[model samples]
Target: MSHDDGYGNDSGRTGDGYSTLGGTRQTRTRLPDGEGGDGYGPRRPPRSSRSLVTVVGVIVLLLAAIAFANLGGGDGDKGGTSGGSGGSKAGAAPTAATGTKPVTGKNGEIAAGFSQDQQGAQSAAANYSVALGSAEMFDKTKRDEILGNVIAPSAVGGFRKTLDQAYSATLFKNLGLNEDGTTPTGFTFISRTTPIGTKVTKSSDEQATVEVWCTGLIGLAGEGSTKPVTDGWFTITMELQWINGDWKAVTHSQKDGPAPVGSDTRASSADEIAGAVNGFGGFTYAR
Candidate 1:
């Protein structure tokens, strides 16, 4: 994966990769010699369109897992539950749902008003990571709205300025989008973040810092797309401060992953990936 560090520096790692929120990679999927050319060239053979209904079914199940993963309880606990009917050991991180309810307020489309405790800080950090990693952040207007909502008031201006430059027309073209950040006529642009779990490394009545482990999917999911949907793991550290009854981010940064080995599951087609992204909805996370 390749990424720009938002400061004009570019870097990348080989093997399976995902782009950082503000950075992007340019890649292409090649077709057989006799088949059509890449999206950059001629038209390609049309793929069968998968049913959005089937995609929704798969999405529902995946979201069930996502909900459980975010509800992982206990301070600083990683992965799943410590121990339960799934036979995980006393301190083992197992993926099990304890039925913990999610947070219940919104500042516009983003979750807001997290608690002042460690759990609250963790939840806030996780949700903010999602907002920061979303495809909507590519749009200038939406980017400003997201930063204003999630960042600390004292620091929002700096974030806005830095990100405005980071998400430049050049970056947009690298990601296969128009200069203004709109998807081309027939492609589905995907940029989403799912938190695996969060750990609070430091805490206080007025401030806390949390690290959110995450897996993100990015690229253009559609027939003839140069960039196909790909996944990668990363961790984001957010320094949060308690201000005006909510947890607001003072600063955040991302690094490569504690990624697991790749699985043997078959890769889905472009239509399926597009259908799934369009059919599923994101969540409001909680600890």
Candidate 2:
């Protein structure tokens, strides 16, 4: 079963959490001034027109203040401030990259030419995670291409054999895919992984161990489909080596996640989910 490893069948446990790209917003509501009387007590006198005008003016000023704050007043720019010495706070650690540019090279649609640093290894691991967990990985030709491009030369043969066994015919059947990993005529298969963050546990000049925290959606989306699309959270640890001026995965493994509590938002319909997955393109990740 898929479990929380972001692979296998959907019969196992899956997360119900939804992804929202932005931060939480707060909405303030104003209530009636008096306690409820259930039409049993004398009706309270309405506020004077002048008092109502004052409340409206205050609200307008509050809104203007909020707008000004959003325009780089309180915490800084919407893209966030740089972590450079003059701009950042002392002893404050940054969880994301401040000013690093994304990689511009590709190896048959996979990212390539990562720098020989911790950030480069992290970016490579994150992008590799997306490739490995994508629907393309189910197709043999694309799978082989991805394995060749991302896996270290020394590990390609063994990793290819192991993944072939893992993505077996039985697993394809369980996922509502054909033996060749194609979906039924009316169904769409969805498998996408988005990295939440990455941390380098160990690093040196030529090798590093990085863990990518990710959330994924995988299933068959179609009417009457038993395995409707569902999401899961998992962590992938990659042993990366700096080879030929790029970071490549020597070996990688996955386990269940340190997932957050599920949200109360209702799941979208299968058709809606399918349409969304087809319409949205995945991102190129960098640290």
Candidate 3:
């Protein structure tokens, strides 16, 4: 995701993404009812009923896919994000450290004020990016709460409303969730972003620019989940303005991968990825 030491490009090359392109797992498929043999042929039950079920299934899948894409992306709105459409800005230097004590926060502060230190800025950018990208941000109730807690109150209303609209019944189903947001049978959906490294691009007293390089796991996890977990690397650069004291995202943007060579290991089952997401806890990072 990082614009390499010399490598470049994280510009949003969103190929025909999984959004409208996800393939469906055919459930309860019906063969043409002609030969009503015992085991070797299709039995004629009700042609109309079978057709109706197929149509319903198709409708459900379309709706679910829309919901999934909307919920999974454009959280900050496109206009507000930064970086060119080609790749990671040959942005200034990447921050090389994590966990360095912040130069601004008191020892016990959880949501501390802006830091003058580059390290602190990078940490702030990374954590804020995670919060902005989390799955909880798609659920209306929890999303509102988190926005109220982290973002400027003025943005909360718009963010909540837009996201609520995005995670509609159809969208949820398309994302492989039931209409009510529960996981579909035998599959788990992954949307985890793990930061590989961070860098402070620009830092001022009140506003800062930091970049987070992350590889995300996004796809359905489960036995029948055709969209298995796939990875996308990104460099997220946030323009953070210290608000009401603590840092908050004023704007952000993402691009596709600086994806390197693939690993040799077999991908985990949908259940495993799902279980891991359920079991793992995310960090409230600070430097």
State each candidate's clash count: 1, 0, 19
Error of 3 at 167 (Å): 2.1
Cα lDDT tens digits for candidate 1, 1-287: 01223310111111222323333221111112121023222222232111211221121121111110011122223342323222221232233344556678898899987766666777888888787777887778987898789876766655555456555565566566788879998998887888898776655456665677888776687778876666667666666767798887765555557889776566778888788889999988885
TM accuracy, model 1: 0.70
TM-score for each candidate, following the candidate numbering: 0.70, 0.68, 0.61
Would you give me the overall lDDT of model 3? Answer: 0.41
When sorted by lDDT, best at the front, the candidate numbers are 1, 2, 3
Kindly report which residue stretches of model 3 are placed more than 4 angstroms away from their true locations once superposed. Answer: 1-91, 102-116
lDDT of 2 at 91: 24
Residue-wise lDDT of candidate 3 within 62-90, one digit each (tens)? 21221110101111112222333211222
lDDT of each: 0.55, 0.52, 0.41
TM-score of 3: 0.61
| Model 3 error, position 265 (Å) | 1.9
Off by over 4 Å in 2: 1-94
For candidate 1, list the clashing residue pairs, or say none.
80-94
Query: RMSD per prediction, one decimal?
Result: 13.1, 20.2, 14.8
